[model samples]
Target: LAKTTQPISMDSYEGQEVNITCSHNNIATNDYITWYQQFPSQGPRFIIQGYKTKVTNEVASLFIPADRKSSTLSLPRVSLSDTAVYYCLVVRYNQGGKLIFGQGTELSVKP
Candidate 1:
């Protein structure tokens, strides 16, 4: 299994975009990348996910390069309410692996 890695913290101003990068150097072929955002009291919510290239939705976009060793989660025009902890998770296609928490990037959106 590839070791998931993310920055401890990041800073951004309101109305600006924030991109958080996660690195999985030993990512397997069947692995998938997913991101989740968590507020103070609520559980983490899904942001975006991708296997390769790009995946976009109403709230966020996920970018995976050809190597698949790393991924970028892009949130557009963030607000103060967007300040939260973002988690990057790796899931296997058929292999039921345990999902680990605590390794996530904390994004602080300032006004």
Candidate 2:
């Protein structure tokens, strides 16, 4: 699998919805799309995961295109407390659950 490309930063007002998208044009057959949320000074928290179509959970929704080349993570009505960095990762077994943190997309929620 290849590396993912995502935005460097995004800004949203409080109570607004935010969507972050990433592209992995060289994604492999065994790769899965996973989203993680991280606040400053803390580890990334698993937000959602999907291999195809849509997967929704309590915190977010992950929409993966059929080609498995890209994915979008949707956060509904984000608040100031939701300000954090969001990461899109290509899940690979060889990674040993060790995340390779890229320059994550910084999500800023303004009051």
TM-score of each: 0.94, 0.93
Write model 1 residue lDDT over 60-83, tens digit each, in one string.
Answer: 999999999999999999999999
> Distance (Å) between predicted and true CA of 74, model 2?
0.3
Task: Score candidate 2 by TM-score against the native.
Answer: 0.93
> How many clashes show up per model?
0, 0
lDDT of each: 0.89, 0.87
Candidate 1 Cα outliers beyond 4 Å, as residue runs: none
**lDDT per residue as tens, model 2, 6-78:** 9999999988989999998988887788888899899888899898999998889988888989899999999
Worst 10 residues of 2 by lDDT: 93-102
Compare the candidates by TM-score and give the number of the best one. Answer: 1
